[model samples]
Target chain A: MRAGTLAPGKRIRPLLLVLAARDMGCNLEQRAVLDLACAVEMVHAASLILDDMPSMDNAQMRRGRPTVHREFGEDVAILAAIALLSRAFEVIAIAPGLAALQKSEAIAELSSAVGLQGLVQGQFQDLHEGAQNRSPDAIALTNELKTSVLFRATLQMAAIAADASPLMRQKLSYFAQELGQAFQLLDDLIDGCKHTGKDVHQDKGKSTLVQMLGVEGAERRLRDHLRSADAHLADACHRGVATRHYMHALFNQQLAMFS
Target chain B: MRAGTLAPGKRIRPLLLVLAARDMGCNLEQRAVLDLACAVEMVHAASLILDDMPSMDNAQMRRGRPTVHREFGEDVAILAAIALLSRAFEVIAIAPGLAALQKSEAIAELSSAVGLQGLVQGQFQDLHEGAQNRSPDAIALTNELKTSVLFRATLQMAAIAADASPLMRQKLSYFAQELGQAFQLLDDLIDGCKHTGKDVHQDKGKSTLVQMLGVEGAERRLRDHLRSADAHLADACHRGVATRHYMHALFNQQLAMFS
Candidate 1:
């Protein structure tokens, strides 16, 4: 019954959301913004619980502890995940200090990211695809749905909350997708290079960008995404000194993890 | 995945929601009402899919067909359920021709109905309770949370959509809870009498009212609830001839089913 047992992994999604708000000159600690961050992390945690179920990845360990299903049984794991998803919307709806329309906008943003065309479809593809038979394009699409859509959602929600311009929101959307892919690629590379006490090596046979591109090619791809992320980060908001510094610090830290 | 594979069983929740709106002089065919109905049913169907999984009910049959998990395996069934939940929210958010705040209200209602204090906690209690260990009070609480709460939500959402007065909404809320319990009681009575091709008989040891209070006592309780339901129906909106006629017809039909 305990959710969020995995601690918060990197909190990249929430951090990106806050930084995106900063880019648009919104206060970082606005109660509504903080609520959105909590809601987003709850969703991420819920997804992780489901993903670790015996029916999904069947991982024995996550973050050096037993997976949720392994610890609480599959039934509780699934129900807890469902509860978290529902609670995320509840969090957004009841968040204080936000206009009514803002609550609706954020709710819409989060719900769409988890529906048929987003995480569910992506997880479906991941489950149905033959480990050795998926094409690069299929793999890319799955990445977008399963791992990246929520990433895109957090940034989009922040932009909406800040009332950024439509063009700026679009730029941030692009930035999110690219950043998501780069994050997954680096994760794969880390797993391929060393054990992570989880299912990382078990998925070695599965098609991934890391396998598709090889180390050098994947590095090149990551660089391209990083550049795109930087450019859009600038365009999505003010590109103030703090925003630039924060983006560089986070991205550079992730990059350094490879060494 | 195929979400509506079970052919949308009975449509009772949506029917109750729409009928509630009709009681308040709302046009039954309004797009917003229709979308709300669809969203309610989707949530019900999603709950059923999970309930039928090997990890939960381990059900072999549902609605006279192989259970979703049995037919498509646990992986697809889980993902499909998740998709349906998300889709329900999406339907509420994007339901055409509704005021923005109305959409937000419905979204909040539905989410809260499914979260830790609503369906999820109810379900957790159901799964965790030993067949013979639950008390009548505990059973009643579980029934309220797991079944009545969602029924309550449907009526509440309908009221919100129709812009009904607070007193009217409260009356409808009471009506919905009584109807939900009555429905579940009748269902249990039917299960006791004959096989429904589902897991009804399999739960003989479970703490249903029929088991806790004998068949005769349970029948009395059901009738009492029907009376309460009629009273709430009168108080909730107005007792127009059509509304009274509709309520009488529905109750008689349900009562006749028991006979």
Candidate 2:
């Protein structure tokens, strides 16, 4: 019952994708990149479904409700995650506006990020090291998996839809990746200090930045990343309107969260 | 680790890909398809790795060796699997002699198969009804995940590579999907009756054809699938020299396995 119990997430990634496309001058409708955006969000949701399973995090609650596994059992949770991921691709593949080649490109980008190197790798790293003693590097690694790579991919996919210039595309990627790390750092900070609904001090054995460098150091790392992310956004400003507004809004929110 | 373990699998899928290319007069070196072929095999391997995890089959052994998780622990096993998967895409994306768009197509095809609709979906179906009583439909659903979709993807990908006629491609896909199902049926027959290194009857509560139909009925289904796979291959015979040999060889092996 993930469809029912789980409050829907922010849906920010897809919005960024569509907004980026608009910046590039492409007209995105429900049948176009909007469909793809949903697909990407589905992937994100699937990751969370799997992540919160008994075998993984064993998390009891998520988004203020029982996780997919808790609501439907582990098997159904796994199946639901798989269903969402597959449907994500199918929806995008069949979307009206994407040409065969473009469809191919979109699938590749999305899959690569979600696939072994991106999300799965990140998960493995997190679990492997999370079980061990704390270290700054360990926390950095987790951010990459749980956060950065996907952010980079989200922007890249958006750029593909818009056919952004290579230089502009690279710049956007830098922005997204850094921002993602910053976001994850904030998440960890929250998770570590406060119990929320799940386990507290659960990351004790893990190589968290906080455990390694103390709270002060982890905060510094996140702040530095925020500056870097903002710089990339400023660079994207040279591109045009849609890109500028999207970057500005996202960064401002993140910056405000930290402040 | 996989490099040392990477012996020639049946090489059935790769050969099909090459033969399909030949049908379109797309002759390339063994080296050209080597990376792609390896990538394909890696995908297969990654699925196997995930399938045997403690969370899934909980098998202690596979292919006569301690499974990846058993040897390296679950965390590392997962990472190794992810590494194989990501490297597969990297291989396809960077394979020599292909244009950027073509490389992108290869990566996309592989990704689609391994992502939601392909292997992951199959895994979901396998786990969805965990610890529950088996039914005929549940068995069929398991087969859909554990076998058919990837086989369909393999042949479809071959056609894409060679730019095969739509009619020819359709026939080829039919051959591969049916053959794959038959192979899985044979696998169940072998596992249910003789295999000892597995959880065997404990399919985490999901049903198999052998479980639902009994050994005799499952055998009949296997035979039927084999017959269809053979007929499809025969229809695809006029395509090319390589295509004919590849199809014939695959059909013969399937027959030989049961005989």
Candidate 3:
């Protein structure tokens, strides 16, 4: 679990969560937000471990090192993944200074993101549908399931922690959805690039938006998503400059590789 | 997830939870108790799926059918296990009539039972140490981790639901530990027996109490545990006749296989 979670990587999901919480005007102590952020990252780490298993993506490298299943045996890898997942919930359940109701809501949000309707469904679809001639809508839905669901959960959790109004939560949800789609598109665009420091050509045979739209068209859609995400952020939170700056910097860094 | 969870089985963990809750004078509506019981069963089902994976026990059969990974692909099976696990917490988090604090406590208990201090550590030790020469104490500790920890959590959750006194909770914990040990020992004794369903001889060549102490000695030890469990239960709850009867019937049925 330590090997998988403590590895070097950009914690983009946690950053998104923290920024969203701040943008939502969360007044909780730093520890509470950090705990929730860590929980989100742990969930991400657990998903990545499973994705790299021999039975899944079967990648050899992750974050520039051997995958968890490669470094440890498969049994250990599976157990570690579960341990991390369990720990993620445990952290939330015991997070100091948060109301029990808030914690329960957060757990509900995060668990759904990891369960049948979220990562599990997405991964299953990707494995079963990726190589098939999937329709554009089907591919986009899978992308949303794979990526946007967790992002939605992250922002929702932040909203819950912040006790934000339902309207604000709705706007943030839209923002997360657009941002998640853009992030995945960026990932698809850079699938085989070197500086990414992980497996290359992972989508080589997969039926992704990038496959159907071609590079230039895909980049156009990516920009559209970014624009929509920015609009939603602007409507949801006036003081979201940090979030806007971080997102643009991150996306530009990835897109610059194409240039 | 359905294939793994809805399969026919005794559902002993859930039964134990319900009975323990009743024994503790839990006054919640039956729905809340049932939901919690289902959550416990889901966790057990998820564990079985992973335990029967090719990398673990590699068993081909479970609950009189092909193991989950055999019936579903490994990827699906893995996802199903995770989904079940996530759903377990989700169920607890949303259980009606449970106070937010109680629900949080239950989630914490269950998650820890599944994490490093419980199933993960136990399985790791078993995989690494079961084949090696291990002391009786070492084997006992492993049994506590693998089996008793979840039982402990179940009873503790019941106590929480009932809002039972701390002293009563401690007694129930003792009862659960003893019962869990006896249950594992009985399972070890029944290895290679056909009427038990599932794959037999799962402990073959492994260093177990059954191997070290032989059949009669192990059976005697099992009896000792049952007796201790009974004593603890009697001390903890005066209105526990139903729990006592169910436990006796279950254990006697398993022990009768020897006759």
* Candidate structures ordered by TM-score, highest first: 3, 1, 2
Candidate 1: residue B79 Cα off by (Å)? 0.9
TM-score winner, 1 or 3: 3
Residue pairs that clash (backbone atoms under 3 angstroms), model 1:
none
TM-score of chain A of 1: 0.92
Residue range A121-176, candidate 3, lDDT tens digits: 99999998899999988988898999999999998888888888899889989998
Instruction: Give the Cα lDDT of each candidate.
Output: 0.79, 0.67, 0.90
2 or 3, which is superior by lDDT? Answer: 3
Full ranking by lDDT: 3, 1, 2
> What lDDT does candidate 2 reach at residue B214?
80
**Most DockQ-accurate candidate:** 3
Per candidate, the number of residue pairs that clash is: 0, 5, 1
Q: State the displacement of the C-alpha of residue B87, model 3, in Å, after optimal TM-score superposition.
A: 0.4
Q: Write model 2 residue lDDT over B92-203, tens digit each, in one string.
A: 6555655555565565566677666567766765665644676776666667656776776666666666666779778877887777778777777667433344445554
Q: Which stretches of candidate 1 lie over 4 Å from their true place?
A: A5-8, A130-132, A195-197, A239-244, B1-8, B130-132, B195-197, B239-258
- Docking tier of model 1: it is medium
Q: What TM-score do all the candidates reach, one by one? A: 0.95, 0.80, 0.98
Which regions in candidate 2 have their CA more than 4 angstroms from the true location? A1-6, A24-26, A86-94, A99-108, A115-117, A130-138, A192-200, A212-221, A239-259, B1-9, B23-25, B28-36, B77-145, B192-224, B239-259
